[model samples]
Target: MTVLVTGGAGYIGSHMVHALVDSGERVVVLDNLSTGFAWALPAAATLVEGDTGDEVLVSRLIAEHAVEAIVHFAASIVVPDSVADPLGYYRNNTVNSRNVIACAVKGGVKRFVFSSTAAVYGNPDAVPVAEDAPLSPMSPYGSSKLMTEIMLRDAGLAHGLGHVILRYFNVAGADPQARTGQSTRNATHLIKVAVETALGLREKMAVFGTDYPTPDGTCVRDYIHVADLIAAHMDALRHLRGGGASATLNCGYGHGFSVLEVIETVKRVAGVDFPVELAPRRPGDPAAIVASSEKARALLGWQPRFDDLDTIVAHALAWQRKISAEGR
Candidate 1:
């Protein structure tokens, strides 16, 4: 069976492509290269440069490739950027998602895996937020992803499309083989920025908000390794293809680390005391948002191998160093 991965050239998506190819599955990548690099994808996977919202292009690829499944990862992900341009977020994350889902259903794709986010929970009332937690997004980025989940649910009910919506927390780290990683220029991920600073790529990194209710007074987030996150996706794909029912699940480690803690881990792992400056919190940022992930574990049988903060930082730092050496 063939799998179509939208935004498959991106960080998490590229990892997914590599995994699929290694498993001897035929893979096709549809990406616009807006925030992704074509070189990030494995050469075994066919790369079709195009927009996900382009109905004609998407439909053509689906029909021609005999695609049985689609894993969507294309979106505007930066929280601060989403706050600055809510319309753009909605257009990219919601409207474009609608078009992609429509094409999948129209083209008779049997299975779909959606890339949702933990931001949909907003500032949860409690830690280790479950999948059934109240949906109250604090940012347009979160709201846009939530809207796509709704569309997927409704579409699945009306049509016979099976789907698994994986609501991810803060995804960090890189591929263990050093093949693909978070290489977006000017990225906003905390771990990515800290790794960059540790490698001297940046003079310093900013610690946003040191007055939150957390122990370290900085934001606390559930940082899941990129490889583990992709493992969850693979499990979800298997569940869907095995006649399993459609479901929404949280993908995380069920624990969190404060910003200060992550910075310290980066320093310890990389042996670099990177400069850090305290800065006011950006708009739409929650103080803490960790995932429960019980549903994913019980249903998808996901087993995370790299749950340690230091491991996550080390992998991220290693990838950053590789990028620097290659002068990318």
Candidate 2:
């Protein structure tokens, strides 16, 4: 049985593709290439350039490929941009996801794994938020993902589809082998931005909001290595295939670091003191959002290997340098 991975050309999706192919799984990628690069995808996975909302195309691919599962990673993820274009966010994230889930049901796909975000928690009332925390999304991006989660839950009950929704915290780092990494130009991910700056690709980076309630006065986040995050998806897929019940799990290290702390690590790891400007807070940014990942550990038997902050930064820096050398 093949696994169809939507957005499989993007950063995290590309990593998922690598992991799946490494495990000897038949993989098919469906991507529009809006922000994802076709070169990021491995040659082993069949790349289908199309929108996930196109139900007819999706159904045909599922049928032809004998796809038994889907790992969906397609969505608009920028928080501030989502705030500026709430309707667009809803259409791309929620409405499109509904269409994909519909296609899965029609195609008789058994398992699904969704790439969700911790933004769904917004500014949680407490740190180390559990999976069952109240749904309070502060941005359209988060709200859009939460809406998709709701649809998956409802669809499972209505159609007997087993699914896993893994709500990820801040995902960073590259494939340990440097085969693929965050290759998107003008990307907004914190570690990406910092690595670019250190490599002289960018002059400097900004630290939004330095007066929050956190110790360093900047927003705090639980950063998980991209490899470890993909491992969680693999375990989730295995669980669903083995008749495990549907689950919504938080993917993180159960801790967090402030913005300033991450910047310091980047500088230390790269040995380049890139300039950073403290700027006003961006809209939809939470003060601090950590995770309680016990459920993922006990339920999926996921073991994170690269949980260190410096190691994550080093891997990201290595990828950035490689990109710079290749003139990409």
Q: In model 1, where is the ten-residue run with the lowest total lDDT? A: 266-275
Q: Write the per-residue lDDT of candidate 2 for residues 1-328, one digit (tens) a residue.
A: 8999999999999999999999999999999999898888888999999999898999999999999999999999999999999999999999999999999999999799999999999899998999988889999999999999999999999999899999999999999999899998999999999989988888889999999999989999999999999999999999998999999999999999999899999999998797899899999999999999999999999999999999999999999888889988
For every candidate in turn, the CA RMSD to the true structure comes to 0.6, 0.7
lDDT of 1 by residue, 1-328 (tens): 6999999999999999999999999999999999999888888999999998899999999999999999999998999999999999999999999999999999999799999999999999999899888999999999999999999999999998899999999999999999999999889999999999988889999998999999889999999999999999999999998999999999999999999998988888998787899999899989998999988999999999999988888889889989889988
Q: By summed lDDT, which 10 consecutive residues of candidate 2 come out lowest?
A: 35-44
| RMSD from true fold, candidate 1 | 0.6
Residue pairs with backbone overlap in model 1? none
Off by over 4 Å in 2: none
- What value of lDDT does candidate 1 attain over all alpha carbons? 0.94
Total colliding residue pairs, candidate 1: 0
TM-score of 1: 0.99
Candidate 2 clash pair list: none
